[model samples]
Target: MSSSRVRKEVDEALYAFVDRQRPGLLGISEDLSPMLSALDVLLAGGKRLRPAFCYWGWRALGGADGPEIIAAAASLELLQASALIHDDVMDGSDTRRGQPSVHRRFEALHASEGWPGSAVPFGMGAAILLGDLTLAWSGEMFDTSGLPGEVLAPGRPLYDVMRTEVMCGQYLDMLEQARGTGDVESALRVVKYKSAKYTIERPLHLGAAMAGASAADLEALSDYGLPLGAAFQLRDDVLGVFGDPAETGKPAGDDLREGKRTVLIALAQERATPAQREVLRRRLGDPGLDLSGVEELRTILVETGALSGCESMIDEFAAQAHVALAAAPIAAEAVAALTDLTVAATARRV
Candidate 1:
């Protein structure tokens, strides 16, 4: 099947699973409908890249293309949803995928209805529960994906590790922000654990293991996956600062306002002159940062060569990913598809 077809299958499976839970959720409390509604909207967005990686990884090991695999891949979408929801809450972001964030939606609902408690707390509470719900459902989806216990057994450890490491990485991310880490090494470390492994390497490993891939094949996928994942996040960081609001869904320079200490920002800070550093420190995380302030920060980022440096790093990682893919023992078709996916993933506006 084509990648689009696989994506469609995953979408259908996800909607079906969510629809099945709607009644039970409503029975518990009609107010819970908004949470699920926001989830439905959130799920409709995103590139479904993780599932695509998972599907292609399974294909690399010569696993047959089947509904079971699609269902299994769809579980990753739930995990992504959970992560994004929580990440937005942590960042104090107001929007996601160009819509009000889960929390903001609930917050608005609270305000509109003149609810008893503070809207801020209510929104945060609802969003937290919504994220928790998605996290719980992700495991359920995987367990019931129709992959036999014997098939899932091998990949189970990696699955557990992916979950555990992502939470650890998230805490690390929060800590880095709290500590104001602007060094390139610390920023890269956060990227590796928070995004690189969880978002790419482990998902590939999970699918490959499900296919009973050999150690050699698994290692090859990691070699391909790790650098590629870093490159993917680097691209995201660039877009976060410079991408169009229409395409990125968030306001322009949203990452800056949120004070995301990404690799791009760290590089700029590292190379900045004293005056430039002073500007960065004062204006980067300001919630009320205006467009002119954003322009100034962008100028500093460009003038300091951080933008070019990050672009160079992206090129290096993409090249490394290709080299690893070429050396892998996977089928020719799988390699070809992965090659295309590499470009689509790293080069896209979204």
Candidate 2:
């Protein structure tokens, strides 16, 4: 299958899950509407990336995507939705996909309705609870995924490791922002922990487990997935700087404003002249910077070769991933699908 075809199939699977899944959780006076709304928000707008990765990984290892596999994939997506919600809160991001984030939307509603108390905190609190629900339900979905319980029991340990890595990665990300990047190695550490294991490795493992894919196949996926996931985040780091606000739906220079210690930034700091470094140091994290300033910084990044340097790294990781995929016990069609997906996904125009 082609990447576009894979995307369509994944969308169908996800929507089928959503169509029958409860739109509202039931409980007397339990505010089921809000919880349902949160769930809808999660399911409504998505690229279905993680779920598709899981599904495809299973398919690649010669297993069919049965109900158990599909449900487990959806559960992984729920986990991603949960992470994203909390991430937006932590980043204080206002927009997602060209619209207000859930908290901001809720806060706007509270203001329009003249609701009592501080609507900002109230909305954030609600979003937090929703995120929590998503997280818990994700685990529940995993438990009830209908795969042979024995096969799945071993996989939970991998999922648990993934979760711990993400939390630790998130914490490390915050610390880097606060404490400043001491060196390139420190920044890469953040990328490995924050984006690699959870985003790709665990999803691959989950899929393989659900399908009863062999241990050798599972190892092959890890080899492919780990590098590919790291590459994914690296591409994202590039886009954070160079992407059009219109296309990315993130404000231009959002990562700069956040002072995220991305590999891109590390390269710039290492390669740029003192004056260029000074400009980055001064303006990189300033949220109040205007468009022209952002553009100027973009120029500096290009001139410093950081942009191209990051692109090279993405290519390297992706190439390594392809090598691993070629070595796996997957069908040619599935390998082609994954290959196409990786190329299109990693080389996304900013």
Candidate 3:
């Protein structure tokens, strides 16, 4: 099936699953209406890439196309949603997907209603609960995806490990921020655990495992997925700095304002002149930074060759992914779909 068709199926499965949960929550209390509404808004957008990877991974192993597999793949979306919601809270970001973040939405609701106590705490608490709820729902969706028990057993361990690794990666990311250093090695580590694996490798592994793929097949998928995942993140890092807000759904140079210790920043710091370094140290992480400050940092990133270096890295990683994919013993149709997906994911504007 085409990637677009896969996306449509995944969306149907997700909507059906979530709709099934609504009455149960409403049964407890209709006050929970906003929680469902927030999730609806969040789910309405996204490239649906993870689930695409999962579905393709299953197809690579000759798993037949079915609603069960689509539902299973769709579960990954909830996990991704949980991560994004909590990530925005951690970063104190004002918007996501061109809308107020879940916490901010709740915060605004509290203010508009003139609720007692501070709105900030209430917003944070509500968002946290929502995130946790989504995390739990991810697991529930996977387990109840209508796959038989024996068929689902093999992927369970991979699903558990994926969850654990992502959480650890998230903490490592926070620690990197706290340490306030921009070493290339540390930043790469954060990328590997926090994004590359969660976004690609594990989803592929989960799907392949469910399809009864062998150890060697799993290894080959890893070789293909890991580099592609890294390139995906590197592309994201570039977009965070240079992409148009209309395309990216976030402000330009937002990463700089957030002081994200991305590989681009690390490379620039490594090669910066003293005067340029001073400008970086002063303006980076300044939440109040303006357009001029952003332009200044953009110039430094270019002049230091950091942008070029990042582009080169993305190309190298993509080449590696292509080579791995060519050698894998995947079905011909799946091979073609995955190749297309690789480009769509890395070369995306949003």
Question: Pick by lDDT: which candidate is best?
Answer: 3
Which consecutive 10 residues in model 2 have the weakest lDDT in total? 20-29
Tens-digit lDDT track for model 2 on 1-350?
A: 45565556655655555454554455344555655765676567666677777778777767764667666676777788788888888888887766777788778868988988889997798789878877887787767767778867767876888788888999998888888863678888888888877788777777666567778878888899889988999998888888888877788888778777888888888999999989989998888888898888889889999888889989999999999988888778678877876786688686
**Model 3 — TM-score against the truth?**
0.98
Q: Please list the C-alpha lDDT of all candidates, in the order they appear.
A: 0.90, 0.78, 0.92
| Cα TM-score per model | 0.98, 0.91, 0.98
Per-residue accuracy of model 3 over 1-350 as CA lDDT, tens digit each = 98889999999999999999999999999999999999999999898888998889899999999999999999999999999999999999988898889999999989999988899988888899999999999999999999999889998998999999999999998998889897989999999998889999899989999999999999999999999999999999999999989877798878889999899999999999999999999999999999999999999999999999999998899899999999999989899999998897688463
Clashing pairs in 2: none
Off by over 4 Å in 1: 348-350
lDDT of 1 by residue, 42-155 (tens): 998988888888888899999888888888888999998999999989999999999999999999999999978789988999899999999999999988899999988887
Looking at candidate 1, what is the lDDT of residue 185? 95
Quote the positional error of residue 317 for candidate 3 in Å. 0.1
Candidate 2 accuracy as lDDT: 0.78
| Candidate 1, run of 10 with poorest lDDT | 341-350
C-alpha RMSD values across all candidates: 1.2, 2.3, 1.0
